[model samples]
Target: MNLFADIRALVLDAITTLVTEGVLPDGLNTDAVTTEPPRDPAHGDMATNAAMVLAKPAGKKPRDIAEALAVKLADDPRVASAEVAGPGFLNLRLEPSVWQALPKAILGGGTAYGRSDMGKGEKVNIEYVSANPTGPMHVGHARGAIVGDAMASLLAYAGYDVTREYYINDGGAQVDVLARSVYLRYQEAHDLSVDWPEGSYPGDYLIPVGEALKDKVGDVWLEAPEKVWLPEVREFATAAMMALIRDDLAALGVHMDVFFSEKSLYGTGRIEAAIDALKEMGLIYWGVLPKPKGKAEEDWEEREQWLFKSTDFGDDEDRPVMKADGSWAYFAPDIAYHYDKVQRGFDLLINIFGADHGGYVKRLKAVVKALSQDRVPLDIKLIQLVKLFKNGAPFKMSKRAGTFITLRDLVDEVGADVARFHMLTRKSDATLDFDFDKVVEQSKENPVFYVQYAHARICSVLRKAGAEGIDVSDATLAAQDLSGMTHPAELHLAAKLAEWPRLVEIAARTHEPHRVATYLGELAADLHGLWNRGNDEPALRFLQDDPVATQSKIALARATAVVISAGLGILGVTPVEEMR
Candidate 1:
């Protein structure tokens, strides 16, 4: 089903033949050989650089190797023509029958037409949306959730054993602030006056948590000291916020396989174990770091503390894991968490963080390399901020989240499908503008609607064919003769379908899910292009005077729909059967 790969193998076979015939040298490396779509469509259907790359190594002229390779390639039944272009590049044209039979192959494969086994079942761990459980999930966390969840799905489709994970930042000063904030609301439940203080969460989302706490321990800790109430309140408030966070993720269709607690790493010797591993590798040390630039030496407190040699792995300077006060730095627990992941036997580790964490990337990668002794690879993706707009003005959301717009707010404003699709329309590293007006527009300018419309149009075609009593079943259409589908427009759409499997491997290999969004947009364009042409050319329409001949065209439409469903599934989007 991978047409490009099949053609590349054919080129290699011809190269081998030339080696045996003494036309080319033996032991020539064909590993660099590749067959890809030609730069210009007028050149040919496909092009190869086998002769150009092998010419110098084989001690042969480029044109000589190309001429010999071309003659050998012409013998294949699949290749209609092989022409030698400038500088010994070989451009190929496949038989029209190859494109004509694509619909049958696509229908046979269904949504799995582009699924790949590229990863060989390697275990991968993707950690994302590790937002603090202080309030409801916000728009930034939503971006991380969609990107990470979609990445896990894409990797799974490419035959990787993927685990979705969330790391909770509960063991921190912020949790203490959240605990105190809930206490204020608890006092309000008791009808007591409380003063508003700085560094306390003012979100009304904590009101319910406070009321629930009062119900559980009615007036028992009403005037208790901080020592007695802080711990219990911290634990209770964190649990409540996590519950709310889970509900928020559920509303957006994202669920994690694991929810790791930062508190778990404390008092468990896990941090020590991770640090010891680095020490054993000579990557951990106690030393005074050089005074930072732009700061006067008198103002800097140069202290010797336990440090990680992040510079060895390209960090600008060594990073301290434990400050002189014997308290763990923010990066300390992260090292232990990643070490735990390595111990779990994951072959690859991926993290999605906010763009502001750019400075932490190299150090994080260094620690994972040190802990795993370079056996494990870590990839970190940074998600930029999202700007929301409506009617060319900044859109304001409800006060449900208090200060920031919550994930639930975004989903409510434009259902989960539109939110998820529009979030990925741009790359993760780029700032995305989520305009309420533009995304919900039913016009072709809206990519999500455009793609969904393509699928819905296909469904309409199938239903109409069924209503007319035409046998449009896959079995019937797949068996119909398609040689009569010789129009340039029909063949163009089929050629696009042939690129699906190849596109899957590229996107999965690069760890980029935005490419799936990009590909779907292009595929929809081709399908719509073919559909639009049918308006002027009556012969190009799917439904013809002859139901039997119409079956072949319907098969092509079905194939396009099948691929669209598969792509959207990876993005965690439901394909629309009909647009309202």
Candidate 2:
């Protein structure tokens, strides 16, 4: 249960009682009231702003109200003490039983311990890793994939119906380059030497695609003109590239629920319909944009081009939907794709884009606002660049990828779990330095290893207890007398455990999965801190000479392990059962 929520209800109930008993005037708005962990833990378990927020509105002094409220709250069995702190902030101390019951709640809830009803089962569509379908995914795409997948998992745990999606950029000019690159590979497969000229993809990853094409056709298109082979080859090569991308994603434990093809936007009335919808809302018009502000400006030509009234919805300027040549601009298909998502009846939409796409955010949000009439909210998370390093220097580029570090290379170097966890250790908006040596280091400073070591430490303790015939399983330890677990250091762990459910809600509400990672790090630190303490103080040791005491202490440590496993499950990281 959410103790903070329960306490807030108690405060609200007391306020309602005060109003009904004529202690306060009627019609006082309590919307601004909040209950949260105080800035200093010594103040109390929680602090409420009910009196402070209601003082001016109720035409009463905050201290006067807080004094009365404190007495009322302290009378409840759940509240051990209530003090009116500075400026009438009500600080609350909960009974020790409240903190002691946390482990039981964790055991009962299992993986659902931190799950929230915040979204109320609302449908959310998350689109990420929509890299150009020209080659295998690279390091940059890995970050987007992990963030998006973890976010989807977080939202789902928070009670949102989430759909993980990928939008293939097959309709762009990049795919045309991909087609020509594959043609060269096809020619090579036919024993003809071909030069991969500038502007062509020279990655050896496509070598197999070329061979596959030859295997399927068997020289049928060997002597054909461009018209005879380009169309079929383009389709064939695009499929092959998508397959390679899927395999790369699979290697990192990412799976998409939907794969939307950009090419589908063409040869259909979808783009026209999306533009028409905007037009009906008076958001579509014909316009010309200004030239570059700083750089050498191109010849400023006044031309009538189809544009969206994005400025009305907070864009820098009106965005183009159709070019003067009657072909759709790049933004046209994106708008149509988001429109399709809206029509599919999602309550929320999230797009994970590379940091370079920061400029596109406003226009995209504007289109969603204009089309969905502000019903569906869109949030764009920009993933910053990942700088890879090895041996204290920059890692060399992948010869297979030709110019960038492919996702497979990173996964092969470090397993999928490490790649995913390390990618999320930094905030999505912050540039991350992926030091190959540091992340894999077996020290407390390494987050991935540190967290995993906490889990492994618990495992080691359990094994030690078992070998000594202490019977330290969950069933045995849970049955032990835990009344001796009253030390401040021990109780402090329970206090941190109490924050997990609230932290999950906060992270999910803000659409920041990195918060979960940060929380996990803190939890692991606290666990390790307690473990290290046991070394200096034998009384703090988890496995004591007495089986009963050992069971109680082991119960506490195992509970920490359970919570860590649960948090890692949300992050899609596999907890290490042992530290090798």
Candidate 3:
């Protein structure tokens, strides 16, 4: 089904034949040989650097090997022509029938045409959007959620067993501040004068949590001291915030398989166990770290503390595990959390962090390497900022979220599909501008609308063909004669469809789901381009005077729809059936 892959196999077979005929030496390593789309389409349909890679090893000139291999490749029915370009590159132009058959393949396979088994069912755990359980999820967290969710879906399409996770950062001073903020709201509910402090969150979102606290305990905790009320209020507030966060994620169609609480690491021996495992490997030590860069010398304080020998694993410096106060440092719990994931037998670990967490990436990787003894690999993707704009101006904060824009607010303005699609228009590490007007605009420049329009247009085509008394069923269309589809416009679309399986494997391998979005945009453009050209050339239209010819064209349109649906599935987006 993968034409590029099939063609590459043909190339390898030809190389094997060259070896058998004694034209090429035996024991030549062909692993470096690759067959891919030529950088310039004019060069040919597919190009390989086989001759360039093997000439020196085979003790032959590059041009001599390329010319010899060209003859063998041209002998195949699939290859229309093979030319030796430049000094050694072999460019092959496949028979038009090769691309013409893609529509049949797409119709037969449906959305499963591009699915890959590259991961081999390897278990992968991806932790993302682990915002603190102190407030509603902001737009920043929305980017992480979309990227992480899309990545999980992408890996799954590539045959990886993926588990989505969210780490609850509840065991910190911020949650304590959240508890005090809720207390103020609780007092306000009781008609008592409450002073708003500097460090407390004063968002209106917490008002409901405060009222709930008042209804639960009445006046029981009204007279209780700080020590007595702090723990209970903290637990209550944290749970309420978590509930709100869950609702926000649900609105955006994001769901986590696991919600790990940082509090669970404390008083549970998990942190100590992870550290001890590293200690047994002689990675744990006591040391004083130097003053860090980007800080004034006077602001730097030196103290001896327990450190992890992360530098041994190529980290810039050894990281501290415990403070001088004997309490676990900030990095200790994270190490333990990832260590626990590695011990659970996950083949791969991925963390989706914010741009601010870029500095933490190296140390986290080092610890996972040491903990897993280099058996498990850890990958961290840092999502950059999302800048929101509307009406040619920067968007303001959300009153519902108190200080910043919430995920729900964004979804309310634009539906989940638009938000998800727009968020992934750029790479995760690149700063993305989310223009409300542009995202909802029904123009080709707006990729979200453009891609969706292509799917909807294909649906329209199917409807019209069905109304004309043609058998538009998938089985009927797939069985049509595709040899009539030799137009350049039709062939161009088929060629793009052939790239789907390869694109999925590439995106999955690089841990970049944005590539799927990019491919979908390009595919949509090609589909649209073909449709627009039909205005002048009546033969290029989907519906024609001949039922047999019409069915063949519909088969191509339906095939395009299938790939579009599959691509959107990886992006966690619903394919549009009709345009509004």
- Following a full C-alpha superposition, what root-mean-square deviation does model 3 have from the true structure? 1.3
For model 3, how does the per-residue alpha-carbon lDDT over 212-311 read when each residue is reduced to its tens digit? 9999988788889989999999999999999999999999999999999999999999999999999999999988998888999889988999999999
lDDT of 3: 0.93
**lDDT pick, better of 1 and 3:** 3
Query: Considering only N, C-alpha and C atoms within 3 Å, which residue pairs clash in candidate 1?
Result: none
- Tens-place lDDT digits, model 1, residues 1-580: 7899999999999988888888888898788899988899788888999989999999988888888988988899888999999889999988999998889988876766888888999999999999999999889899989999999999999989999999999989999999999999999889899886987888889888889999999999997998899999999999999999999999989999999999999999999999888888888898999999999978999899999999998789999999989998888998999999999999999999999989889999988888888899999999999998889998766598667889998998899989888888888999999898899999999999999999999999899989999998887888889999898888888888888888888888888899999989999999899999999998888888889878988999998999999999999999999989
Against the true structure, what is every candidate's RMSD? 1.5, 1.8, 1.3
Model 1: how far residue 435 lies from native, Å? 0.3
Q: Per-prediction TM-score, please?
A: 0.97, 0.96, 0.98
Q: Clashes in model 3: which pairs?
A: none
lDDT of 2 by residue, 61-82 (tens): 9998998899889888989999
Least lDDT summed over 10 consecutive residues: which range in candidate 2?
A: 292-301
TM-score order, best first, reads 3, 1, 2
- What do the candidate models score in CA lDDT, each in turn? 0.91, 0.89, 0.93
Candidate scoring better on lDDT of 2 and 3: 3
Ranking by lDDT: 3, 1, 2
